[model samples]
Target: MAEVAISDAQERSAESPALAGLAAAEAPRAPAFIVTIYGDVVEPRGGMLWMGTLIDCCARHGLNESLVRTAVSRLVGAGRLEGVRIGRRSYYRLSEAARSEFREAARLLFAPPPVPEDWLLCLSEGLRDIDLPLPWARLAANIALAPNRDDLMPVDGILMRAKQLDGHGDLAVLAADRWSLPEVAGAYGDFLASHGGLRDLLARNVTLSPEVALALRLRLVHDYRHAALSDPRLPRAAYPQDWPAEEARNLFVCAYVGLSKAAEAHVGAEFLSPEGHLAPHNGETERRLFQLRREAAG
Candidate 1:
């Protein structure tokens, strides 16, 4: 599952200037990488990861050790992570306060979407943006639609599910109308162009260092996440004649599948126990990755 420790959005993680300069040049903030460390790697490990394990994992993704160290300390201080010293080594886990949110985030990040029972048509004129229980698209200065039901006359705005609406059209049209297609498609296109190159490079059997493979994997997933997660799961009729989401998704799966083997090898090597045993594949990552491959293939 992918997530950041969230306070406001019930998402995201720590904030500090220690990682500012490097963040500007490299990947996301150290805190963000820490979030990745949790969602992509650590959360699967019973919410605990060895300190050295984290240092090594983040390094593969291009984070500096010192920055990671700082972020870890900041997280511990901020009550996001609990550190315990076992023998001569230290391990970190999600704090009691954070575990529930992390688990909820995992459900969204990892689990397949349930069959659509209903869609919420949220109208907010003064509020501009509304926060629904569903994932994605909390920021737009207009009405929004979601594929969930909330049966209460909320104080903020009207949460209208399919039953409440008098009119009807293709459900895809609702999704298409609620969001800006041009903006969404443009993002999808840009990611596909880059990810398509990654697929080609991987197909060519180009050699990549562990660090380079990790970086490519993370960037590919992160950008794809930004575009795809925000999508309203609209039907093809909702998009222009040729929507790019399917192509983008395939590129993501292909690139990720290509990068995963090497990346996992690097992780296993890096996350050794004090007894020198390699970290075991917990199977969750593999399960999700294989499912995605199947989705791409299908």
Candidate 2:
């Protein structure tokens, strides 16, 4: 058995207030859509936007304006957003607590994947009942492995280098026990199938209407972000054979880059600034993300 150790710091972080209401409120479809919108547009672009601009952005995705308004109201009630009104104009910003949550998300999504130091196979009592931030996989009773140690949780458990074991007997089975490789791979596969053909068509120099461009862009980001959150986002070694992650990523890049100009045109024309003018609301955050994507493609 490997030596067991506990991390006090990790325990405190698990109960951190920044992550409140994430999984709970996101169960409903409208809230989920609103969260996606926040990730794609609101969070990155100076973190504040008018209510009308938000409604118009959702409208491109075929969401009703009233429905979008309701979603925003619920999000504010849920403590994820702050709503402000000046005269007749209304605006919302990511609550400071919510900003911390999404900042970590943005870091994970954009940074290059890193290899972990070691895989800790831990056996501890009351693990299921205890709240730790480990990317947990339950082995028999009172057993789990920390696949992600990037942010180690405060827990007492045996530790060992991943290379020390040949993954014999139970270890071989435990990897599967920890994460459902097939399901994660299958999600990537489904994502690729849904968007692949359109990506290829765009690659062949097809044109899209401004509405279509913005709508498709939102849909693609919405789905991709959801997948990223659900996935363990392990290293390439953790993937099963025939994993479609790279393929899905390619389709995402192709479609988003191909649609950028038209989508920007639409937002620039349709979404106005706080000044109530038809000025383009381009910001550095948007440019940086697009630049990162373009660099990744090349």
- What TM-score fits each model? 0.66, 0.76
lDDT tens digits by residue: candidate 2, 161-192: 45434454543334544676666666676666
Candidate 1: TM-score? 0.66
Off by over 4 Å in 1: 1-25, 60-62, 96-111, 114-118, 121-145, 148-190, 207-211, 234-238, 273-280
Residue-wise lDDT of candidate 1 within 86-112, one digit each (tens)? 798887777877676555445444444
- Steric overlap count per candidate: 2, 5
Model 2: how large is the Cα RMSD against the reference?
15.5
